[model samples]
Each structure stands twice: as structure tokens, then as C-alpha cells.
Target: MLLRKLVPVFALSLASAGVSADRLKPEDAVEYRQSAFRLMSFQLGVLNPLHRRQAYDDEAFVYRAETLSRLAELALEGFTEDSKGQQSRTQARMWDEREAFETRLREFAETTAQMAERSAAGDSRATRDLFRQTLQSCKSCHDRYRIE
Candidate 1:
């Protein structure tokens, strides 16, 4: 709900700011992607307690899930050919096996979006299951494509 409204505003702000993805240097793209992932990691911190049933904040969880979903959508845009050789945890195989790598990213995006929807619907069980799938997606990609 809030995310839906905020997204257009965010896009308009970025556009007005003249933030051109294509104009970014390779290292800039690497930094951009890493920053998104770092935020995603921060958002994921809520999952452990929620999964354990020790804590549950519906509003916060929904917001974080939606934010994570949006970040997943943006993350892959940073994997440009120009960014391939930048110093990062990204592996050469991400480029060598671009199709497979991208497929994994899409999977992550899908899982996150589903989790967000479930969270918004107040379905804790489904949200928790989807969250685990989201974590597995991250682990899968990291195992296959990240250096460490």
C-alpha cells in the first residue's frame, strides 16, 4: 500500500535527479549493487525472530518485505557487462553463465515478492515459508556466483 505509492515518487525523484544507470562507472555499479544487498541483509534481520515465533511486528515485517522485493527488482540492473571486472564478491561465472545467473536472480525476486504479498495479507505461516525460500534463493546464488 505505502510501498505502491512511494515507488512512483521514488522513480520520479531518481528521474528528476538525472540518475542514469548507463552513465555509471563499473565500480559505481558494483557499489550500487553492494549497497542494495547490504540493505537487503538489514531487512532480513527481522526474519530470524519472526521465524522463531519469538517476535512479530506486522507493519514492520510488511514494510521490510516490500522493500526487499523492490530491492530485488533493482539489484540485477547493476550486473552490467561494464561492471564484470570490478572488485567484488561476484564471480566470473556470473558473466560466463549469464542466463543461469539471471535465472537465480529472478527466482530471488519472485520469492521476495511473494513473501511481501503474504506479509501484507497477514499470513504469517505463508510469509515464513516464503521467507525461507527467499533465503535459500540468496544462498543458492551466493554459492554459485559469489566469490565468498
Candidate 2:
């Protein structure tokens, strides 16, 4: 019985490891960009509804904040390398604006972290403010780096 349970668990772990080992190639840039954009949009969608509420579940806020942080990190990573095609949505000035993009990404991450911390501390007002600021950073970066 123990062996049976252990075998299935081991197989599942191996399967997941194999799936994760498939690195993103330049050919996959479009899909990766879309996926990352969707994640950011989803996180912001959640925050939009919560802005009017005075109090929100701390755990929920933290979860969303973490998601935003991860999305920002992924956005930075996605732009690190070149795509296979010449018609990418990435801006032509990305190479020149690299430093500015990195700064904005870091600011988004820091603001999201602050939001998480404030939410955990039960500071709704601060959390809301930080969330808005983080959203603005995301918008600014997208406006400059993202073609659409």
C-alpha cells in the first residue's frame, strides 16, 4: 500500500518537473507576452473592484499583491531576450529605454510588497494607496514598452 501511494506521488512530481524544464524560446515570445499580460490584467481587475471597499480580507490582498509582484518580474524577464519575429508588440525603443523599464519594474515590485505589508498590518488606506501607485507604474511601463 505504501509503495503504491509513493509511486503515484513520485510520478506526479517527475511529470511536473519535466513540464517546468521546457524553457521559453524566442519563438514562444508572443504567447509568453500574452500570458503575462493576462495575469497582470486579471490582478488589476481584482483590485479595481476592491478600491471602493473600506475593508478587505488581508489574505486576499496579500495574494493579489504577490501576484502583481510576480507579474512584474515576469514582464521584466520576458523582455530580457529578443523574439524570433520582427513584428513583436515590444517597443522599438526598448533597447534604449531598458534602464527606465527596469526602474519601473522595480518600483512596481516594491509598491506591491508595500501593499502586502500594509494589508497584513490592517492598514487599508495605505494598502489602497500603494495598490494605485503600483497600477500606475504598470500602466506607465506598458504605455512605453508595449506596442498596443
Model 2 lDDT per residue over 79-140, tens place: 54556354677787876777887777767766886786788788888887887787678778
Candidate lDDT values, in order: 0.75, 0.68
Tell me the tens digit of each residue's lDDT in model 1 across 1-148. 4444444323222335665679778998898888888888888887666667723337777778777876875677677788887889988878899988877776677677677778878787788788778878888888988897
Off by over 4 Å in 1: 1-20, 54-57
Give the count of colliding residue pairs in each prediction: 0, 0
Candidate 1 global lDDT: 0.75
Supply the TM-score for candidate 1.
0.81
RMSD for each model, in Å, please? Answer: 4.5, 8.1
